[model samples]
Target: MTTDAADKPRAMEEEAPPGMRRVPGGAFQMGSDAHYPEERPAHRVVVDGFWMDATTVTNDQFAAFVAATGYATVAERPLDPAQYPGAQPELLVPGALVFHMTDGPVDTRDISRWWRWTPGAQWRHPHGPGSDLTGLGDHPVVHVAFEDAEAYARWAGKELPTEAEWEFAARGGLDGAEFVWGEELAPGGVHLANTWQGPFPWRNFEADGFTGTAPVASYPANGYGLHDMAGNVWQWTTDWFAARHAADPAKPCCAPQNPRGPAMEESFDPRQPQVRIPRRVVKGGSFLCAPSYCRRYRPAARHAQMVDTGMSHIGFRCIRRDPQNVQGKQKP
Candidate 1:
């Protein structure tokens, strides 16, 4: 595969779909060996030119989608009684998982200390019952399940980026760099993205000017001129979750082009045998990532999110593979 953008039109010079930025075709090192186990065995990958959203999809944009299609997000609809089997009726109502800071310190291994299931919680009502999108129109829409993202992408005539594609784009031509901007998480004592400032779960100094989700584009854009790729909220990708990347051939001959994830069946969590829900890859950590705990705020970092559920920290953007197909912006 070609590693030169000169082989095709330059990304910034060409016309891109509205709210999107063109990523020039290129090959780059796709993962990290030093960070998490899932990012190990860093391999080479190539992707064709594609247009990606400048930022994570925002609450106002998602609301426009909902209003146009009368689409209710997964969190807005009632849970299937058959799916839950014998759960309480109250627990079967429309709701979503929300994050709440714990008092002082607690067991970091147990996530339940900071997360709770709140009834009537959805994208609009992020906090659960009374919270609304009031001043958060610019914030990335949360509590959107994988299906919800797909719906929004479909409405916009775009699709979710593959894990390889997302990683490549998030790198912003800074191949193998630690963070999106550079080696340092916060270079020169400046916050480049909205990541957790202090300790995890219990304490957040809000040094990045945000405790929860920050509004889209609150920080500097990467080389591709895309924002919120490192933090703020986790973005969904089309690829299914795998423990690690498959081993690859040496540099001379084998660079996978547009590589995808493993089969859906392979995405099932071995740790959870009873629940059969498959997981998809979510990139770029959220505000929940902290130095003391989750350090997945980097581009190579990835997590497996259950397809059926959407938490308050998960959101997504869209991609357009065929630039010719982009017709301005969707009415919705």
Candidate 2:
């Protein structure tokens, strides 16, 4: 809830930095009409005009922040035994883990085989201590948790967009368009974003012109002048995660105005039983997105994750509401 006077209005026509866009806000369908259950109950959400990042935060931007503030990511922090009871003593290493893809069909029951816990995998050394951002400075910084994103936002005098604002901006003014560009993911047989071009976790044809993370703004922009909203990486939002429409009998199905998600609960997790879990909603699919597998590229799509967990695909963008527009203010 930090605010700064330095974040005042500037020239609207001024050119935005790389991986950012100006989202002229209006009314749009926030949730999905026929996608994941959580995105159901197609709700109308009105957002005041604001500027948003055209793409997720990149490695270069994150590196600058770290250098200026000397900020350490959550993964680099020591695990507290009191918080995570029964955690193995060996697991309390001081480095972040990296997930490396292996050849073959991994066991569906144990997906952890593909995701190895590598120590010293921070933002600078994404793959491990030996790996560095190097030539991939323009690529989105991954392995960032919600708190990490928030810290970066605060340092930059920005904040994460609410779920309502995120969906409205992500739609790019198409109003219920299936994908960011159009109905077809590969229009005219051309890949638009950095997504898997082959079998899931097995092989990537690199048809989209990238096997892994692509340079930001390497693809076409959406109708609203946003880039890589469909793929590349999953962006974090400020809303707390809630169940799908089918599970919430008391939830409203119609379009909501400046809607924030349900109040934070004591506990929340997608894999756990349908109990109250306090997780945040993550929007936009990642490079791993696919029709045969994770099809969350749609604008109305959503996924949930624990606020503390950081993965290679999860990153974030920043937003700020127009000072004159109070209607879009988030509820306290």
Best by lDDT: 1
Q: What TM-score, computed on C-alpha atoms, does each candidate reach?
A: 0.93, 0.87
- RMSD of every candidate to native, in Å, equals 3.6, 5.0
Residues forming the 10-long window of minimal summed lDDT in candidate 2 = 1-10
lDDT of 2 by residue, 1-332 (tens): 11122332453545665556777656665667677767777755556667788777899999999999999898888877786666687776665546666687666456576666767777777788888888989999988988899999989887788887787777777887888777898988998878877766767778888767788889988766878888888899888877753222245444345667777763365567654436888988888886756789888889887787667778899986666756665443
User: How many residue pairs clash per model?
Assistant: 0, 9
Model 1: lDDT to the true structure: 0.86
Off by over 4 Å in 1: 6-13, 270-274, 323-332
Report the number of backbone clashes for model 1: 0
Over the stretch 1-332, how does candidate 1's per-residue lDDT look in tens digits? 24555735565566768989877778888888898888878888777778899999999999999899999989988788999888888889899999999888899989889999899999989999989999999999999999999999999998988888898889988998899999998878999888887777888998889999998998989998899899899999988888889788766467777778888888865546576778999999999999899999999999989998879999999998865533222211
**Any residue pairs clashing in model 2, and if so which?**
20-54, 43-255, 44-255, 95-120, 267-276, 267-277, 267-278, 268-277, 268-278
- CA lDDT, every model vs. true structure: 0.86, 0.75
